[model samples]
Target: MNSEKQKLSVLIITLNEEQHIKSLLDDIDFADEIIVVDSCSTDKTVSIVESFKNVKLIRHRFVDYTSQRNFALDQAKNSWILFIDADERLTPELKSEIVTAINSENVASAYFIYRIFMFKNSRLKFSGWQTDKIFRLFDKSKCRYNEERTVHEKLIVNGPIASLKHKIIHFSYSSYEDYKSKMYHYGILKANEKLAKGIKPSFLLQLLHPLYTLLYQFIIRFGFLDGRKGVIICYLNAYSVYIRYKELRTITSSKI
Candidate 1:
């Protein structure tokens, strides 16, 4: 279809995402164009992408998630852009809904899609991971990823958003080792963001944060319903809090 008649573009930012890129790309083949903004990955990621036809690839250094997303947004030629993570894939239902939504004139500027987080090739229904909504598909001009932080990049937009029904599968972590590595890296970024904002937690507060996280995720969120997997996720979530605080303390100590 022509740009004016029926045009939808897929934007994915990647860095060493060789394992997950092919699966994600396979699901969104219905899009008119696919733009991959890579951060100089030193893996087979770029080579695999080169095998795909009509996929536009751009390379740039990694600064943060927001700027990388903005780069991809600028490269998207089509008016409609669906931003997705390299580890994420659009389901059949979501593709159908997106195509339908694009054809409609009265559809909202952006929409939130449910995310299904998976671990060890199994979908985690509980553990506060399922039924999570994230604003991903939006008009390129109306929205942008906030450049304020790193780990949790917020989609800062001026208008209201709509919701979609289908789920986007997220194979975020393959193993516990990978999860721990991510915790350390993301915790560092989060601590830096907090410090930049002049926010600091007291000693007791920081210590209690992890415990509260465990309680909320395991009990309040009913994570235990998911069985052993739920317990593991809750523990990991709590550990993330501890790692963030430790990183924060390290930053302060280094400055002193």
Candidate 2:
């Protein structure tokens, strides 16, 4: 098939994302089709998406990230797909690269995209965030999200892969409180998932495990070079780790 004729389908899953939906929709409008698999949001998110051109909105019951994402994948009509989160933006460089790649005669089955995380309107260059990469753009026939993972779910690609130099922007958190709330929520989800696997968070593991992540991110990964921002990230990471095990311990103790 000719590269220019190969259309790209962009997909996203949303709940109540009024604050970030419209901007994101506008950013990804360059794609041939915009597929939004919303989780029945009781807000202006759906209406905002409907206002966009070349967009198709489908509502589904929320379960887990992987399940919702996999469901979104099935909704795409094109062979090429690009997945973007509500808090992410498809930058101009990435947009051009994506179109160019799909137009290539010999394109990889999947592409790994790095993220430029935003916090307080600042781009995080370190704090272990520089390592944030995901297989987001790919041929739908050769890729699918693994539904088993509750958090940190990954896409399973069945063919050759490549990387893009440009990065998509991610608005990681709006405020410190928001970050903590996310930590609390994701931590519990992770804990429950671990419990389901028959893995227990021991007394020491609960305490020490989190510190290891802090050290690794701040020291080993040079998160400290990011300055005060790095400190906050490292601390939040440790807090999230602790919260996950704390939730795990609570859940397990109740069962006992």
Candidate 3:
């Protein structure tokens, strides 16, 4: 298939993402079309997108990450879709890779890209974090986000997957406060998911899991190489687990 005829589209789901959308838009403007599915942003998110003629905006209520993403996919008018988060930007190399993939004859229906996670001014490359890949680019017709009741949603694909060369830049945490707050929010969602499915963890399991998580991410994942930032991420992940299990116990005990 010819590259120009493929009609590549970029789909993004936003909610008060004004601070991050500018960079995302700048990087992905190379797409044939841009679709923004917003859950009613109270900030200037809509206005900023309004400045771009290539961007099409759709408003919908918040359900979950998967639902919002799938809704965006349903509205896209392209055969090829690149799903990007508001905080994520496609690096120049990644954009070039996507173009090459779209123009190729035997490319996979879905492709994974490495992610470079940044926090504050530091990019943590180690402490057990390396070669982290996400299935972001997909053929819209044969792929969609699974409507899973989880915070980190993944795409469901029907064809072979490929890997991209450049990394997707993820501004995961701008501040320490933001990181802690997000962990709390994600912990709530995880605990609720566990509680809904009748999955129970023993007290010992809860106590040991957080430590194991910290060690795994820091030692095994090599997050330690990220310096102070790596240590912070490892600690936050461990704390997130502790909070999640604590929430789970509370919810379960209430039901009993």
Candidate 4:
């Protein structure tokens, strides 16, 4: 079958992301089906999603990313699913590649797309983010999320995977405050995940991890190449690690 003849579903999960919702939805109009699984957004997000045609909106309670995405995958009608975040936009080349890839014979169970991270509207080429990639596009039957995870969940692919050349743009940090707020909360989530798994807190992770993260990103990863933006990102990354362990300490303490 030709690329245009093959159908695919695009799935996205959103909360109160009114400021960051429309761009991603507008970019993936090429998909045969666009499904938005929202966790009860009390903002203009729902209205904006309602404006798009060929888009089906679903309201589900907020769970971890893995379970929520898996639920969204189940709601998808097509054999192929493209999972995207609210801050992510599909480039034209990637959209074309995805359409072509889905229709190809002997295709693998999934595909990996490299991500370009944008911080405060500036694209950061260094800061150890250049290697960022995710396996998001896949055949629904052969792939599902690892629901046991509480954060940074990995997809489970039952078969071989392929790769695409073009990149997906991730406007992950709209502002410095936004980045800090999100990362701190992410720290809490990660800490809780570790605690639930019976992983005890460690002084090495709590005390040394943050410093190691800073040096690794700034020096080893050549984060200085991005100049001021790189320095900012590097510091924030280290801070996030610090917060994670600190939160873990608190969780462990509360239990005792």
If both were scored by TM-score, which would come out higher, candidate 2 or candidate 3? 2
lDDT of 2 at 196: 81
Best by TM-score: 4
Give the per-residue lDDT of model 3 (tens digit) for 1-256. 5545577889988888889898788877688889998899999999998888878989999776777888888888888888888888776778888988877888898999889887766677875557778888889788877665667787888988889888988888898888898888778778887876888856986899999999999989987778788889999988888888999998888988
What's the C-alpha lDDT at position 199 in model 2? Answer: 92
What lDDT does the true structure give each of the candidates? 0.82, 0.87, 0.84, 0.87
What are the runs in model 1 whose C-alpha is more than 4 Å off? 1-6
Cα lDDT of model 2 by residue, 1-256, tens digit = 5634788898899988998999898787688888999998999999999988678999999877888888888888899999888899877889999988877777899999999989879988888888899888899898887766887887888988999989989997788888888787778888988998999879899889899999999999889999998898888988999999999999999999
Evaluate residue 114 in candidate 3 and report its C-alpha lDDT on the 0 to 100 scale.
89
Per-residue lDDT of model 1, residues 1-256, tens digit only: 3335658889988889999888777777898999888999999999888888878888988877777888788888887889888888777888999988767667777888889898878888877776588888887778877878676778877676888888888888688888777776777777888888877746775789989999998988889998888888888888888888888888888888
Worst 10 residues of 3 by lDDT: 120-129
Cα-based RMSD of candidate 3? 1.9
Decreasing TM-score order of the candidates: 4, 2, 1, 3
Is 1 or 3 the stronger prediction by lDDT? 3
Q: Which TM-score value belongs to model 3?
A: 0.92
